[model samples]
Target: MTATLDHQPIHSWLTDMDGVLVHEEAALPGAAEFIAALQQYGRPFLVLTNNSIFTPRDLRARLSRSGIDIPEESIWTSALATARFLAEQKPGAAAYVIGEAGLTSAMHEEGFILADSDVEFVVLGETRTYSFEAITRAIRLITGGAKFIATNPDVSGPSAEGPLPATGAVAAMITAATGIRPYYVGKPNPLMMRTALNRIGAHSETSIMIGDRMDTDVKSGLEAGMRSVLVLTGSTQEHELTKYPYRPTAVLDGIADVVPLVEQLTPHESVELDED
Candidate 1:
């Protein structure tokens, strides 16, 4: 059950939330066991998601309803990463924010002012209600020379019915009108992974990233110098592996398979959690 990458034992974990652990409000096979194992072993870990619609507290409640007991502090969303990035880039900056509570809450916590006129940035995040008036306003603001920032680059998000237009899709529309591309702060940028690592005080050399997507999760983990594992419980299929030039460090059937690996992680002196 000892999981090692490049002969180094893994002491920390970064896992994608939806596909690898749950699907449509249902916990995937062995997900609970994987989390339980991590908790039992005192391994530092974080549940990552590109979805910016809900806050960590909201996500924790949702997961708890599904019988997964993830702590609110253990959940990391694209909204939080975006907020952290912006806080470092420009403290107390004014922004024209377009998103839900998750995005807005993070911005407010970082001391960002959400306004319409004379903003320094136009921040975009995922929301079920994509208002035409809001999108138009975002386009106008960006056209007026405000820097564009998006939570994630996911073009579409999965729902009970089917795929829904997400941040990337809206960002594309804004880009088309303003001739400016948005700075995405979520997965595939590696900034998200790095930030999560920093939050847990974990190093990339001894951490593992588990995700269901090859494009975002695996790619970001690989770039961040962590071991990447692709689980087939989500979007990317086994056959689709041939399409990507880069491969994950390991491929498994689902998060259930990762439970045993958690028990095998090398022991660390202390578990650190970033409160700020």
Candidate 2:
């Protein structure tokens, strides 16, 4: 593992949402404090998530309810990255979308037109309800020469009961039908990381990505030229570290361990407390 000292002069920070900050609708230990430290030090940061079922505002409310107090603009979803990519690749292009408000709202914000036919792309995103009709429409659109795109390549997502099918799983089904694979815009693709960094006007060389998963989060950060930190509070466990070929810049027990490092990695002034 790379030493934390090598990550000096970190100008910005990025972290995963679910396991790193909150789990089961509650903020993890030191999660809020880590965020507060960053804010106190004027660090540019973003809370990243692959879930595209909700918009930034919606996520902000959810996090606030969980006692995270994250601002709307500080949240970056895979939906937003996909929208930005499409907008840049084919500005104002029409598309057949299979997603909820999060994905649709992003397209709307990027001036994309949503349609069933005569479209340039077939976009797939995360949603609680995956209608067969929508899937059929997406397959048909792809077969008709429309490009296929997905917000993230996650096969399943965590839930109270168990894992639920995600965008990648549906994308696989669509590919089986149309023989055209959708381009995934989220982790472990570095595109999502780069897009998020660009959104905050931060450079990857000076940014550190903190995540719990080695496959998506850590890999994406490393590929994006940013230092990566893996916390043990999520899916990946300490014993599982040796299973991966690559390693993170640092590993810690949880987000709590990162709070003090926030000031150590960034340039900040010290304030003296008067004796009582």
Candidate 3:
């Protein structure tokens, strides 16, 4: 429906990465052109993700391997949002972090001192392997009066074998143990979307939020006042849309289908390869 005559004029854009642009390490069709369209139109945009495992530099390289060319500055992750949130809440605070390089790097960049104990916050993120030792330390810290923060709320993610426990699942275990709920700072939270929009100088009204999941990307965008687009390329399916209380502005098969609409949206734009 994106290429139809009744399409709205989108001044800026935000899109999810995994299912919308690439799936299982392969760039989906039209993923490249969709990004090209945004640049051609001189539209300020950011690619959003709930995964906090990789930094933008890492993600940029991964996307490149999949044939999608996105600059490091154009990519936004839960780690970045989490870091921004912590920094705003308390500059130079200490945190007991449980995650990978993405989360740790973000905390360090935000002037957070990684503490062994007696920290202000317990930060959790995604990792290939969840350590009992690490989670135990996190529980101990949170129970000791440190605030609990998680990058995203996703319970499981797809893998070659099957679904694997994600950050949310681990957070649930911590919550169950300590009787404390961790503040999720990723998608489905308006804070993440608003932060991304602010970084790109885009307004929710003029921007479009595109994603494969209705629960997070679509819902968060709608809640943040942006037009939402539900793509049927990932976790959420067509039959699932009716289950949600809210709806996207439009639905499309995948990002590949967005190419024509993008071409039309930036007719006068001098499209170029953005290599930053």
The models' CA-based lDDT, in order, is: 0.90, 0.90, 0.87
Off by over 4 Å in 2: 268-276
Q: What TM-score does structure 1 among the candidates reach? A: 0.94
In the range 86-156, model 3's lDDT, one tens digit per residue, is: 99999899899988989999999999999878799999999998999999999888888999999999999
lDDT value for candidate 1?
Answer: 0.90
Per-residue lDDT tens digits for candidate 2, residues 1-276, read 335344246789999999999996999999889999999989999999999999999989988887888899999999999999999999999999999999999999999999999999999999999999999988888888999999999999989999999999999999999888889999999999999999999998878899999999999999999988889999999889899999887788899988877766544322121111
**lDDT score of residue 67 within candidate 1:** 85
* Cα-lDDT of candidate 2: 0.90
Per-residue alpha-carbon lDDT of model 1 for 176-254, expressed as tens digits? 9999999999999999999999999999988989999999999999999998888989999988999999988778888
Please name the candidate that would achieve the greatest lDDT relative to the true structure. 1
| Candidate with the larger lDDT of 1 and 2 | 1
Better of 2 and 3 by TM-score: 2
Ranking by lDDT: 1, 2, 3
